[model samples]
Target: MSVETVGIIGIAALFALMAFRTPVAFAMLLVGFFGTWILGGFRSSGAVLITETYGAVSNYSLVVVPMFILLGNIASAAGFSRSLYDAAYAWVGGFRGGLASASVIGCAAFSAVSGSSVATAVTIGKVALPEMKRLGYSASLSTGSIAAGGTLGFLIPPSTGFALYAVLTEESIGRLFMAGILPGILMMGLFMAAISIVTWLDPKAGPHGDHVRFLQKLKLLGKAAPLLAVMVLSIGGIYVGAFTPVEASGIGAALVILIALAMRALTLSAFYEALLDTVKTTAMLFTIVIGANVLNPFLAMTHIPETLGTALTTLGLGPYGSLAVIILAYVALGMFLDGLSMLVVTIPIVFPIIKAAGFDPIWFGVVAVIVIEMGMITPPVGLNVFVVKGVAEDVPMSAIFRGVMPFLMAMIIGLLLIIAFPQIALLIPNSMFG
Candidate 1:
């Protein structure tokens, strides 16, 4: 059989494996391995799998993943995440739907360090949900805000989503990191706006939080300052070229550890748990990377990406029209696949089409991340929604999905604005690099 025909069959097998509930990593690895064996000799396929596994695990840039994950886990264990939320609440809690706004702001701040939506949602949801409930905030507004806001973890700097995107596309991680800043801020503001509208339409849905004195606010900010400082030192250092991503990540992790120990907030048991959690999360991410690497070569040999790119360019839809189709495809896939799996599996196919159509790759990275973020709140397979449900066990899952709808609308608006003005994603990166 021809190699291209084998590639087509491999693609079919991939979807079949996924449909049968095989883990995405193993599915990709299996398809890539056996397809290559079928096309080439057994020896070559074995060599590909072994070498790619080692290379993915040992990659220097990927060290940023674990360090950042460790930094976030330690902060959560140490109660810094609570401090961050408290600070936001102190300042914003008095406004209508203020606690929900604070939840979003809290998620964005935490995203600067954590970089995982599940972690962001869990940490903030654990702290925010009960308080919102006590303050009489509606379940939909309370849970929805955090579920949507947690998505900031994927769009903000030090994001695992962006890190994996960089690895897949060979884009500059630093540039992508910088690129995400304004868009992240934009999305956060939009989320807050959605909160305002929700409460404005139905005042009782989110009652005003207790008024915090200016002195108390100052004290809360003081408690939150250490995290802000660490974020500035690490993410800020990358922006100024004062450190590589690896250096920034290492420094961030070490700083968080020292701060936690110095503050006496982290017990040895908690620290041990943080380390173990980091290791498990890091291992899962690494496996996904390895699987993608294994699968990519088989796909390349089949020339599927090239063929898809050619087909896209010849469609005469024009660039923006074509982009709409790609975005739609992402939205559809988001309902079924988790964000990371969607990113790794699809970028190899969509990226070439994007490049051929003349969009800036870094800008597209921001666009792709934003669209995937929406999926975190999108129903049927809304990962963040499920994560939030774990924290608010009493809230019906349907209510959680209902709650995210406003924020989901907010995401669409934010995405449209970014598309209309690409500089929202590119401004910082261009200014810093140029």
Candidate 2:
């Protein structure tokens, strides 16, 4: 068989393995190794494998992954996520559908700390769901809000999604983090607006809870202040050039650990567990990254990216039109693939197309993340929906899907706004970096 044909078959086999529930790391590794062997001799393939594996894992920038994950895990162990939710609840829990709105804000805040959509959904769902239920909020709205809000983990600064994207594309992680800030806040606002509209149309779905006095609100704010400070010092420090992404992540993790110890919120066992969790998550991320690195060289040998980019360019679709198609494919794939898997699998193929079409890689990163966020709430494999379902056992799966639809619409609108104004994603990064 021809070398290009081997690459084609390898791509097909990769998808088949994934469809059968093989892990992405394993699938990519297997396909990439053998495909390279088919084209080049065993010696070349083996050398490529060793080189990519070592290079991927040994990358200094990858240290940010574990540090940020540790920061998130420590924050969770310290009960900072709960404090974030409580503070948001105190301020916004009195408005019509206010609890739901607060859930969105809480998710956004915790996402800055947690950086994983599943962690954000699970943490905030545990805190927010019961209260919404107690307040007689509908299961759909309560669960839907939490599930949708969890997506913020992908879009907010310190986000694992963006970190992985940066590593894959060789973009500056700090710039990508800065790029995410405004878009994240804009999407959070759109989510709140969705809640308001839902409650305005059906007040029974989101009845107001007990109002907090001004002093109590201040107290709640104080409780959440440490996390806010950590977020500011880490993410904000990066923006102002005080720290690189890695330093910010290290300092953030250390600061959160100190704060947790100070508050007596984290037991020794809990701290140990947080460290273990960080190690495990970091290991998983790096394995997939290594696998992707192996596959990338194999794909390059086949000229698949060049071929596809030429094919798409030949189609006469304008830049925006071509982008729409790529995004639509992301949305479709998101139904079955997790965000990280989707990103790693497709970026090698689509990134060349994106650049050929004249889109900024940073802007495209934000756009890709938003589409991936949509998938987190999409059906069949909406990971966040499943996380929220585990927390809200009483809420039916279908009902959770139903609840997520409106917020899904909100996500779509936020995406459209960003597309119409690329500056929404670029303003902070450009101003700071330039």
Candidate 3:
């Protein structure tokens, strides 16, 4: 077989392995290693694999991953999730679909501190789902809001996805983090608007509740102050150039540890568990990244991505039309794979096409993250829905999926807005760093 044909077969086999339930890292590693061996002799391929693995994992920028994950773990262990939900519920719970809106607000705040979508979904779901059920909110709206909102984990500052994208693409991590801010806020706004419209049109979906006194609401705010402070210190520091992305991650991790200690939420056992979870999650992410390093070079050698890029450019689709196709592809893939897996699997091919079409890499990163966020709320393999279902076991998985439909619509609209006006994602980064 020609080298290019071999690359194509290897790619197909990798997807087959993933579809058969092989772990993503293993799938990539298996295909990458064998593809390398096929393209070059065993000796050269083995040497290249070893060097690439070490080089990918040993980079200084990669350290940010564990630090950010550790920070998120500490924040989750610190009881910040409850505080955020309580504060949001106190202020927003009186209106129609108020609890659902509150869930989105809480998820956004939690995303600032916890950068993993699953962590955001599980943590906030534990706090918000029962309350939503108690208030008679529709299963779909409550579950969907949390599922969709959890995606903010990657769109807000301290985002793990952004950090990974920055390292992979050699973009500035600080600039990428800055770029996400406005788009994240816009997403939150769109979600809130969606909830309001849904409840207004069908009040049965979310019944209104008695208002909390202003004093009670203010007291709830006090509980959330520590987390709010952490968000400002970490994100604000990065925005103002007080610290680089790595430095901010370290500082944020330290600050979260301190907050957890002060809140008396971090017992020795909890702290140990947080550390172990961070280690496990970080290990998984790094493993896939190293595998991608090997696989991407092999794909580059085949010129598959370049050839695909040329074909798309020649299809007479303008840049916008081409971007629409990429976003649609993400939506379809989202149903079948986890967000990170989708990112690792496709970015090697799709990113070059995006850049070739003259889109900014940082801007495209934000767009990609938003698209993946929609996937988190999508059906079949929606990670956020599963997380919420795990927490609210009484709510059927089917109901949870149904509940997220409007939020999914909201996400689609937000994605469209970002794509239509690149400045939605670029304004903050350009203002702060340009």
Candidate 4:
């Protein structure tokens, strides 16, 4: 049988595994190992597995994943996430839909540390949902805001999405992290604007929050300052070349733990739990990396990516047209696949087309991350939506999906603007790197 035909079957088997609720890492591993054996015999498959496993686990760059995740887990245990939400609420809660807006802002801040969309959604949703419910906010608006806002975790600096993308594409993680800053801020603004539009259309949806005295606002901001400062120094340090991504992650994790202890917000048991959670999360991500590495070699042997790229070029679509098709494909994939899975499965096939078309790789990274973030809220597999549902238990799942619709539109708009003027993503990375 032809190699390409075998590759197609492997792809189908991978999906079948996923449909059965198999973990993504194992699914990829199973498909790649058996498929490689089919094409190259047992010895080659064994070597691929052993070598890829060691490479993924021992890669020094992966250390950032554990450190950044620990930083976030510890921050949550320390109650710093609450301080961020309170500070945001103190400033914006008086406006219509202000509480919801604050939720988005708080998610962005926490995302700077956490870099995991589900974590951002859960942490902020737990804090903001109760307050919005108590204050008579509409369930759709309140729940939708947290769900949409959590997507920022995948876009902001220290993002595991970017980290994994960098590892797969061999692009600069620091550059990708830098590239995301402006777009992340822009997305947060768009989410807030969507809240304002919702509240304006139906004032009953979101009542104005109580006015806070300036002194009280200042007090809450002070309480949030420690984590806020950590975010700035870590990200800013990257921009100025003060440290490598790994260094920033390590330092940031250390700073957060120290600050949490200083505030007496973290008990020893909580600290231990954070460490355990970090280890588990890190192990899961590493397994995915190893699986991708194994599968990638099998894919190359089958010539699927080369064949697909050639077919795309044959379509007579200009670069922009080809890009639109790719973007649409990503949207379709996002509905089913998680961001990391999409990145790992598709980048080898797609990145070459994007590069051959003369598009900037770093800009494409931002665009890809944004599209994956969109998937986090899109239906069927809207991971963030389900997370928000877990927190706001009484709210129907349908309400949360309906609420995220406007923010999803905002994402489309933001994505178009970035595509039109690539500089929005490129400006910071260019200025800093050049």
Candidate 3 lDDT at 14 equals 89
- Candidate 1 residues 160-245, lDDT tens each? 99999999999889999999999999999999999999999999999999999999999999999999999999989999999999
Tens-place lDDT per residue, model 4, 175-284, is 99999999999999999989999999999999999899999999999999999999999999999999999999999999999889887899999999999999999989
Off by over 4 Å in 3: none
lDDT for every model?
0.94, 0.93, 0.87, 0.93
User: How much is 76 displaced in model 3, in angstroms?
Assistant: 1.8
Candidate 4 — which residues are off by over 4 angstroms?
none
lDDT of 3 by residue, 38-128 (tens): 8887886788789989988998887778988898888778777798899999998998988888888998998887788888888888888
Which 10 consecutive residues of model 1 have the lowest summed lDDT? 305-314
TM-score for each candidate, following the candidate numbering: 0.98, 0.99, 0.97, 0.99
lDDT of 2 by residue, 235-348 (tens): 989999998999999999999999999889999999999999999999999999999999998999999888888888888888998898899999999999999999999999
10 residues in a row with least lDDT, candidate 4 = 304-313
Candidate 1 overall Cα lDDT vs. reference? Answer: 0.94
* Poorly placed runs, candidate 1 (over 4 Å): none
Q: List the residue pairs that clash in candidate 1.
A: none
